[model samples]
Target: MADLRTTNPDPASPYPLDPADVTPAGPPRAGAGVGLAVPGRATGERGFVPPASLADFAGLARAALPAEVWDFVAGGSGTETTLAANRAALDRVAVLPRMLAGVDTPSTEAALPGGRFALPVAVAPMAYQKLLHPDGEVGLAAAARAAGVPYVASTLASTPVEDIAAVGGTVWFQLYWLRDRGMVADLVGRALAAGCAGLMVTVDVPVLGRRLRDVRNGFALPPHVAAANLPGGRDDLAHQGTPGVSAVAVHTGAVFAPALSWADLAWLRERTPVPLLVKGILDPRDAVRAAELGVDAVVVSNHGGRQLDGAPGSAAVLPEVVAAVGERCAVLLDSGVRGGTDVLRALALGAAGVLVGRPLLWALAAGGRAGAEAALALLAAELRDALILSGCADPAAARELRTLIGG
Candidate 1:
């Protein structure tokens, strides 16, 4: 039986990154990249060893990315109060472990409306990944496919849907609700045609957040990076205007649909063929409404605390929404999910699964495909270990464990 115990890794030591963690260690599948024990530094890279701690990837990403790009990826809106709260809320939930129960090799598997997960973790979408590494979404998708997890490709991805799909395996497309319905339908059509199993429509960000870091850093995409999926290309999202104002905010004002309503979402539901998930829901009432609209899932998110500084972390509100609609539709979460214990905590709180954001981006930036793949492997390992210690065999048992909320 596999040992279901894990300890925090030394920040300096290379994690026990086995080839089977994210790569096909035994036999190569079509385009799975060098399946080996080498965790840090993908093929043809130099002097980078994968770190054990997911938090350590941040320094590597910072060193690899330009200041503005880092700010764009890492910074939140306003004072980032909600950003801090996101992590703090996760820390507040204390898991009461059940010892001496016959549990070994605990299962980390999860079932979502999208598909089966080897573990209840999904890659949350972030924009302009090309800036992180040349592999971008293609590399990330390959890693996720190898890990048996879902990858949510951003609408603002530097790679096109067709190119992303060409990497093989079904993916989930994240849509931003662009102003034109024709364009919206077109993007959805392309995503569906490209074999995306799910459509994650982000209902937050009627306007982009006031990320002071981006403003201070004068963040702008390099000339080479452009929205690959958008026809005719978009100069707006790729460029920065003025030094102090948020370029993203300006872009959202001109490009996104602020007046969007539940009716508009209902319209989208009617047209979309794959499983549809609403990506931002803080209120249980709103969750109920989305379930009533027959959405396959409602992702409990505060846009990773990027849109509203005042809002609470998604985990803080997870249970209420789950209670309201857990039976009606799947409930997922995003924002401030750092490690497997966090995933365990979320499952215990009634989240069907948790979407990880910044950590994987850091991995992609630091180690490209290898780093991204290792991120999921690390989390899955941790979740499995946690389940064994807690005497839970699977995600359903995880939901029934004793939980104490507080410091």
Candidate 2:
């Protein structure tokens, strides 16, 4: 296993998603993903053409996976208004580039509350990966390791978090904030013991958003898949639904603590020694409160439009959140992050880094580990191009970029 966390297990490094690299480097940036093997295409792999773009991966994955599975992956909460808004919000942000600033070979490396990564992006936590492809989270983590990025293993990951951590890269565990504090505490202990670099507490889903498509499709995990980390290997996450009701919403309403609040967040902050990040902050006040409570970071997200059908896109709310807590804690953004330009937009808006969601899954479903690597490489290359063109020499410099909304 990569000793990135082993070497610096107590990663309470100040959140540095700011205009400068002001955050303290907790320890020598652990080998910068040294143990993860970089992948190269082999000639013997038959008929597999690497994806030229994320959309290409989406196309391939759509055709390859079952329609029900695709719906489960692609569908969102009622009316999907928030889902479409996520992409539209990203589309509205335009970067105004500088002339003759002589920036070239812009370094994509960025530091977050967890660790520095090859790019300013990490994989967003999603669950039950085996349903997407047989290789699942393990394969995806290997690819992320190879690309020098962090993988936020989901609470509902098909494989155990310990196994995912063993894949030899920086792994952060995404906790779902279950009603049982003891159960939650045990999960945290397991992740820390397994050498996870950080613990991100997802605070959005007090109850699962009612997804209409899942209701119409009546989706559920196949017999072979289960949430491996839960005691007794129980898979309680509501992955799908029935004709009239969203099973996920119903189960979530019960299994998860609908009463989860700021006090609960405070409890979590005290429970774990690792860098604690609070995910699902759209309001500036919430961001401020989290920062005040000693949170190392906050992920501004709408759960990839999977929850809260009417909520604004993460990009739309990012600037305000950063303005609220950018100086106090790291602010990360997710939702509708389809390309490198989006990453640039997030940074320009004051996010320390961005968490990529569905595109990586599309790549994984399209071509397994190699596909995921290809996706990250494509994003990194595109981010470098955007930075160079805009004369931003490093990821942090993008913070000073001038942007116009609705351009």
Candidate 3:
């Protein structure tokens, strides 16, 4: 495979980049860019240069973090078949560019239940962000504020909900249905009090999938990175005194409701007046059912390939889910989204929007607050180029663009 690093022949030029120099490698770095960072940009005190692409961010994050932490962030369930499939599906999609349309500007704004966003992207919920950086969710929230996108706070967030809310951005709360109803109620109330715009109930992770990397690395949350949102600020520990088992695994078993059903969703809907979204719906039937149950939206996800090892890629299943419920409600996607062109393809394939996960985490690990901001900026910039090239003058019009499969 070709080297995926983003380099510059002459670091001064900002425009009219060489096409040969900017092209990605093979399947591994399919959506990554090369040498896209402009020279003489602001740098962090540590001389941290912003990454040029999502792949660059991933490399930096891997180099900076501990082996266990990197594995936890990057690893997928079982053989990681679904993880690879997500990228493979995206790689197969080819945009059919239109020429001489006289389109000068491409608008990226997209509408959600509460408001319109600058792009059709939102920060997907991820657990234990503090493990990656000191700034944690607070840093991510600030970055999301700067990027004009929503930040979905995970149920297992390292920072407290109130602190993240204080950042004053478009925030959504992602809930992992807990066994205790009272605990669930408390979390819901806290999120609402903190000014969250919507509630995304994650239904896929009834039990944590067996992640081989975490098992081999013996990964567990450090003492500092506790799930602050949980009652008593508990961490995911296997047991108070267990020596061998992973704490996260133990926590997953104790908190998540294994028997959760659609009826429980109705119960949740009754409790929160905010827009309720059912996340991790890969099946068209589930998408239809979620909409029928009064969900404001349904997120088409395979839990970022972290659950169900053999499941189809989120992108592979997106078109069917969109067809099932596009008229009934919004159909957002998440899994292996790398950059703007991938976003464009997803829109063309019928996703209303997408939720980005690992790339932001990689950014946080690479350069903390500044890295996260730079990552979002890079994606937005790329999206603009993609829209102009794909013959869409506006992001909303991306839905009408044609896609050639197996490109």
Candidate 4:
């Protein structure tokens, strides 16, 4: 491994430390503007100026999208208590930086069962991406490929699995455990045939949570945007609902399997050739159980706080889950991860990597493929800065740093 640590340049140190010579890197790539460019139309042909930060990207997305589509992308379950908690919990963790330790060019590489990613970040599965952009999951997979990260394709994706897989990245399939076993098997076969590297079984949403925003918006898939992976085609995947009910609710009630249990893992395990990971785990016991059941990994998530309104934040429960299963299998995290520092915090708390949602969609909505690429690049740059400033030379070193909670 390369030594990323460099001599510190701070001269006011009691101990012998090199003088501070760190200078801010120049402006980010063409599309990614960090205090260098403003958000607007692309400057030249085949180029665009992305927002300076994820928040800015979100603002652009909100401005670009219709009210209903924005609500579907940003809203959480009823009351959004879990959503608030997720941000609050992450905010409570204070990063304790170390000085005099030489660190530069910090490596953010993360190893998954499929391959090693350039950063400890992956795109989480989100439904109906076509609602955000015409490229949908295919665009996301292309962005992931460009970023050297993984893309977890959702069962509810607007594009078919084969098309997404054809984008040529580390693709992971997220199964919702539909009510019909035949449909489930067929989907799995499609994903496998499409060359997905792993299977992420989402076990949290036995029933869709009551999303008030969607209800108020009378959210339903537009006639054109449909789950393209289903057997009966787009018509079968069309979500039907009334004014008070969300299309998500109606879809789940019709297809989501409520009787799924641990015993069913065997059936899935036997059907797939790739590794299996259970997503939406918060409890330490569940993490342990996943390990016992031969799961390759477990994501400490609360469905991005969209499934259960009162559930604990994924960040708050990450340490406990890590303590329980750190030795058995890889522990990834999702929900409430907003930036590079958040990614570092999760790694310090024992997450192998972090799955990012919402923000990527925001970027995609804002500028299509170029915007999404800029978003990933911005985070990669931020992670590098965070690692160097925190006196860590790599993700492994960041993980070894001491963390303070409730600060």
Cα lDDT tens digits, model 3, 197-245, are 9999999999998876566555677777788898774553632424445
Ranked by TM-score from best down, the candidates are: 4, 3, 1, 2
What TM-score does candidate 2 reach? 0.86
Give the TM-score of each candidate: 0.87, 0.86, 0.88, 0.88
Give the local distance difference test score of model 2.
Answer: 0.76
The collision pairs in model 1 are none
Q: How many angstroms is residue 326 displaced in model 4 relative to the true structure, after the best TM-score fit?
A: 2.7
Instruction: State which candidate has the highest lDDT.
Output: 3
Q: For residues 1-407, write the lDDT of model 4, one tens digit per residue.
A: 11111111122322221011111222222333111122345565446676566545666665556556666767678777787788888888888888988887778897865668899888999987878777677877899999999899999888888999999979999999988888898899889988999999999988988877678756778777787887664344246757776776777678889888988877887777898989999999989998988888999999877898889989999999999986899999899777788898998888888999988987787677777888898889888888998999888888887889997
Model 3 clash tally, residue pairs? 2
- In every candidate, how many clashes are there? 0, 0, 2, 4
Question: What's the distance in Å from true for residue 341, model 1?
Answer: 0.3
Instruction: Flag regions of model 1 displaced more than 4 Å.
Output: 1-48
The residue pairs that clash in candidate 4, if any, are 5-103, 9-19, 9-20, 10-20
Please give, for residues 1-407, the per-residue lDDT of candidate 2 as tens digits: 22211211124522111111011212222212211211223233422356555545555554455545655677677777788788888888998888898887778899987678888888899988877666789988998898898899988888999999999889999999788888888899999999999999899888888866566656666666777888763455454434655555565566677778888888888877889888899999999999999999999999978899889988998888988885889999988888788899999998999888788886776666767777888888889988998889888999899889998
Model 3 misses residue 180 by how many Å? Answer: 0.3
| Model 3 C-alpha lDDT versus the unseen true structure | 0.78
Q: Name the runs in model 4 displaced over 4 angstroms.
A: 1-39, 233-241
